[model samples]
Target: MNESLNELLYRSFDTTLSDEEQQRLDEGLKQSEGLRQEYDRLKTMRRIMAEQPQPDFMPGFADRVLQRLEDGGDASGDAQLFFEALWLSFRRMGTVALLLLIAAISYNIGSSDNVSLRSAFNIPETTMEEIIEPDFYQELESLR
Candidate 1:
């Protein structure tokens, strides 16, 4: 009647109980049939576990990883292709910009002598000083 069957199971299976506690548990077993049945069930479970062993798994998990690499499933290759397409678009835009800049420069060279009667706002050559550097204009400036 005084027996804690849970405490007895913990003591019998886990080996953490004191001698006085074990003696008290033994006395409790004779006093109560319900406590004795619970204790017997716990003991039977522990005995069955000691008889059967657990299974272990195989160790070649790295083989699957190596097989994936050999099959060209790398994410870096996909990212590289995306970046290459982006770079090609940027290069095409750069070529178009360079062609427009060259055409503007050629037009200015060819249309220099066309004089008009209208007195509109005239943009000074110094405004384009950096676009056409001083050293580049030095030969033409000396002839003036």
Candidate 2:
């Protein structure tokens, strides 16, 4: 029901409960059915654990883990080399693609018979009539 009661109950299983803690735990178990049930469960668990054999690890567990890490370090270096080669391949492909695109555009511009690249983008040529329009002179005279 409360932390103090739970601690007392656990301590009791461990045979470490003080007289005051034991009294408190006994009063709590008497007052609350939940506390009594939890206490029984914990006591059974403690007894089951005590009855079971302790676990044993193989020797050199730490050494085996270190060995695995050392082995994995080589794999990391190989992965880095693989990624670097992939990036270099992509860069070379990009440069070749750009060169091919430029060559294709140059060939298209040079092979065209109708309009040259310069003429296609050039401003329209002005006629003498447009340059010497009477309305333009009138506007200029008005501005002056």
Candidate 3:
């Protein structure tokens, strides 16, 4: 069976080709010199990349990671301590902010005067008194 182009290239490197195939490849290579040059460049780049060394890191990276684990990190096992601290601070401040807002609104609404609800709106004092007190309203209902 005839081999695929990739299989033919793989066999060309790690194994010996049959004399017929070798002659055929040589004729093709002679016809396209650019292909042969590109193949050589790719082979050299692959070899160089495989041989390249990894970069070194700071010495304390592992120690800092272990320290974070001891401090109770989350599921991802990293950044848990920092995130938890930030979340707690925000939660506490948010609760305080809501409480302050509630207190301010309560004070303002309780103390503010509305003309529509006052005697100045042309309502009599008796009507204003009934509007201000539930006991007065109950008495008026019983009289009626």
Candidate 4:
């Protein structure tokens, strides 16, 4: 298709074309078989569309659309609804994670001699070599 006259060809169907544009479109159709087929297809489509009756909208179409627009305008509301739905879906997993955290904290506190929050989480000061040695577990077991 010739880019220069393609727009002119489509325009000739909807609006009156100038003599110069019509001549250019005619010359293009004569030069390109493909363009001529496209022109024929457009003409057939326009004729078919013109023959069909215009479709009517359902009753209350405007009211329904306006109601939807009014109800769906809040972005924050939509986000909050999505978050609430997500929380509902994963509440069981959240419960399990919370239980596990509490159990871990309780175990740490019970294992500490001091029974204080600081002792429950504190790491004993030790050289890196002692932590890596095989005897570390044996020494820790003996202390217990």
State candidate 4's TM-score: 0.38
**TM-scores for all predictions:** 0.35, 0.35, 0.37, 0.38
lDDT of 2 by residue, 1-144 (tens): 688777777777658677787778889999988888998898788789889998867999889778978887465577889999999999999999999877876766666555665544443567654778788877877898
Clashing pairs in 3: none
What would the TM-score be for candidate 1 when compared with the true structure? Answer: 0.35
> What's the best-to-worst order under TM-score?
4, 3, 1, 2
The digit string of per-residue lDDT tens for model 3 on 14-78 reads 68999987776666566666657655876897799889999878999989788868867454544
Enumerate residue pairs that collide in model 4: none
Q: Give a tens-digit lDDT track for model 1, residues 14-79.
A: 676688877777777787887878877877887998888876557776886687788786756778
Candidate 2 off by > 4 Å:
53-144
Which tens-of-lDDT digit does each residue in 1-144 have in candidate 4?
A: 777777888898889988888888888999999888889999999999889998889999999778868888565677889999999879978999889878887888888777676665565757655767768866767787
Could you say which candidate leads in lDDT? 4
Give the runs in model 4 whose Cα sits over 4 Å from its true position: 57-144
Arranged by lDDT with the best first, the candidates are 4, 2, 1, 3
lDDT of 2: 0.78
